[model samples]
Every structure is written in C-alpha cells, then in structure tokens.
Target: MGNARTFILMAVMTALLMGLGAMAGGSQGAILALMVAGAGNIWAWWNSDKMVLRQQGAVELSRANAPDLFDLTAALAQRAGLPMPRLYLLETDQPNAFATGRDPQNAAVAVTRGLVAAMSRDELAGVIAHELAHIRHRDTLMMTVTATMAGAIAMLGNMMMFTGGRDNRGGALGGILAMILAPLAAGLVQMAISRAREYEADRLAAEITGQPQALASALARIAQMAGRTVNIPAEKNPASAAMFIINPLHALRMDALFSTHPPTEERINRLMAMRA
Candidate 1:
C-alpha cells in the first residue's frame, strides 16, 4: 500500500510540474522542463549521497573515532538486512538526524551532536533505524527527484514573472497576479507530496525498529528543541528542509501550509497504535 501511494504521489508531482511548465512557459517550455527534471533525477541518482551529506556539513566517522554510534548503526543495518551505511556526525546542537543516498548500498546516516548527547540508547536506536528504513526504501531518491522537479517549477514561475515584466505580456495587474500565484501553487503541491511520503516513512521506520515508542519519544524531543533553537543553515536553504527527520527552519505559521512532515502528535499516536 505504501509503495502504491508513493508511486501515485510521484506521478502527481510529475503532472504538476508539466502543468506549471505549460502555464509559466509553453508546450516547448514544458518539454524543456521535463528534460531538465529528468536530467536532474539522473544526477541525483548518481551523486545524491555525497551532495546531501555535504549540504549538512556532515563528517565521516569511523569505529575508531565514534565507536558506539558506528557499531549501533552497523547492528541495526544487519538486522534490517541492509549494508552498513556510512555514519556521519554534524556539529549542530539541535537534536536531529537524517539519511541520504540513492539506495541502501550507497547510503549514509548523519546525526547531530545534540542528538547523540540527548537521546537514550533505545531512543537513539529507534532514530537510527528510522534513517536506515529511509535508506532501504529509497526515500532519498524519491525526495531528490521531488526536489528537482519542484525547484524547476518554482524557477519557471520566476522566469515567467521577469518575462511578463519586460514584454508587458499580461499587463500590470495580470503580471502581478501570475508572479504571486504561480509559485505559491507549485510550492503547495510539492508540500502535499512531501507530507504523504513522510507519513509512509514514519510507518516504515516503526516496522524496521520494532519499537515505535522510542522513535515517538525521539520525535517529540526533537520537535520541541527544533522550535527553540535555530538551524541557521537550514533557514538559509529552506529547500533542503524536507530532507531532515524534523523540519529545521524557524517557526512560521505558513510552514504548516507547506509542512513536509505530518503533525508530530499524530505521528506519535500512530506509533503507539502499532503496539496494540
């Protein structure tokens, strides 16, 4: 069911991009955007693991350097029937973590310093397992593809705005409306698909960990601290926010409209239900 949902959502995102292309540019532009989006998927498929880890400023850690964490991930990967993905650590104080890679064989998992210091062993296992699930299920690939297309749609909207400015294509009021509405619509579509994938990932994580409560606790703690502290880098590059287990940006009411993750309370409730 989850797999089917993911396929459907991906198709929807692709169609949305095509429409945005047609609206902002034209039929030729639509073909161009599709080509761009396809090329991006190819790029992400080959290099996403390195790119995402680099974006987070994560550093490779070995058993000699970070023995416990390394061994923990190794053990969980073994249990999950996955390769031992590279482990990384971030310098941030926020308790957050994420996984990145095109597939299990190429995967890497990174946890913040704060996450290591803050979570109990069981809780940490749940978190790590969740990331492993993402790696195993190819969430990284899905997200990368989605980001590439959504970004193109948003960029097309920008191009339309500027073109309208110079050509007087839609006159003053009409141009203003296109400039404001187009990107907003595209962003909302991206957000909807992102949110759905997150829910499915959460459920998959619970199955991988076999202990939903731990992930639930970890999520609650992460959500509380995420709001109080600032992930300045994430704020500067909000497009990558969807990659994290928790949204890293500062609180904005509008973020709810475009949240990548489902509500924390609801996620926890679903986790708890798994025990029954």
Candidate 2:
C-alpha cells in the first residue's frame, strides 16, 4: 500500500509538471518538462546519497574508528539479510539517523554524535534495524526521486513566473497560479509519501529486531532531545528533513502538509502495539 501510494503521488506530481509545461510553452514545453524531470530523477538516483552525506557533513566511519558501531550495524544487516551498508557519523548534538543509497548493495546509514551518546545498545540496535528496513524496502530511492521531482517542479514554477508566460497561452494569470500552486501541491504529495513509508519502516524495523519496545523508547527519547537540541545542518538543508528518523527542523509546525515524519507519540503507540 505504501509503495502504491508513493507511485500514485509521484505520477500525479509528474503529470502536474507536464501540465505546467504545456501551460507555459505548449506541447513542446510538455515534452521538455517530462524529459527534464526524467533526467533529474536519474541524476538524483545516482548522486543523492553522496549529496546528502556531504550536505549533512557526515564522515565515513570505519571499523577501526567505530568498531562497536560497525559490528552492530553488520549484525543487524545480517539479520535483515542485507549487505553491510557503509556507516557514517554526523557531528551534531541532535539525536537522529537516516539511510540513503540507490540500492541495498550501495546503501549507507548515518547517525548523529548525540544519537550514539544517548541510545543504549538495544536502542541503537533498534535504530540501526529501522534504517536497514528502509534499505530493504528501497525507500531511500523512492524518497530521493520524490524530493528531486518536487524540487524540479518548484524550479519550473520560478522559471514560468520570471519568463512572463511569453511562449505559451497560459498567460500571466495562469503563470501566477502555477507559480503559487505547483510547488505547494508537490510538497503535499512528498509529505504524504514520506509519512506512508515511515510507518512501514517502523513496522519492518520492529519485526527485524524483535525489539519494538526498544525502538519506541528510543523514539521517545530522540523526540524529547530533538526538541531542545539544534541540528544546524538539517536547518540549513530543510529539503533533507524527511530522510531523518525524526524531523530535525526546530521551528516548522508539523501539520499534515508540512510534517515528513508521523507524530512521535503515534509512532511509539504503533510500536508498542506491535510488542503487545
């Protein structure tokens, strides 16, 4: 169901992009829009992981530098029947983690310094298992693609507004409407898809670790700390907020349209129910 929802939303977003293109420059514009979106998705698929890691200032952590973290992730990967993904450490006090890659074979998992300091061994396992679950389901790829498409739509809106709708019959009125609506619609779709996958990842992680309670506790603790601690990098790159296990931005109000992660209490309740 999550996969289906994501596919539908992505299709709708693409169609909207094409519609905007047609409005801006006619049939030829529509074709160009599709081509641009396709090319952007492909580029994001290959390089988004590296881009995200670089944006977050994540440093690769080796067995020599992080023996216990490496070994624990390896054990979790074994349990999940996945290859050992590369591990990274983010230098931040905010407790959070995320996984990124094009596929299982090339995946990477990153956690903050605060996460390592805050979570116990079991809680850490639960977090690692959750990230592994994302890799297992290929959520990382889907997420990156959605984000890229959404960003492209926003850029298209800006182009239409600045270009004065000169080439197509959309007119200044239509251009203004598209400029306001296109990115907003894309953001809603992106948030919906992110919420759906997050629930699925939570469920799969509980099953993988057989420790739903630990994850629940970890979620609770992370939520508490994240409220007070600042994640400067995430603040700087709010587009990447959905990738984190918890929402890292401090001031953004989390409503249906704005939130990437589901509510912490609800997520914890679901995990507790799984344990029960």
Q: For candidate 1, which ten residues in a row score worst on lDDT? A: 165-174
Writing each residue's lDDT as its tens digit, candidate 1 over 1-276 gives 435544664566566666656655568757776777677767877887777777778899999999999999999899889999989998889888888877788888889998999999988998898888777777777776666666665676566666663345465554456556655665676577667667667787788778889989999999998888777666666777778889888857965866777898998898899867
lDDT of 2: 0.88
What's the true lDDT of residue 112 in model 1? Answer: 91
The runs of at least 3 residues in candidate 2 whose Cα sits more than 4 Å from the true structure, single-residue gaps closed, are 1-6, 167-173, 254-256
lDDT of 2 at 183: 80
- Global lDDT of each candidate: 0.76, 0.88
RMSD of 1: 2.5
Instruction: Kindly list the per-residue Cα lDDT of model 2 for residues 180-200, writing each as its tens digit.
Output: 899888877777778878888
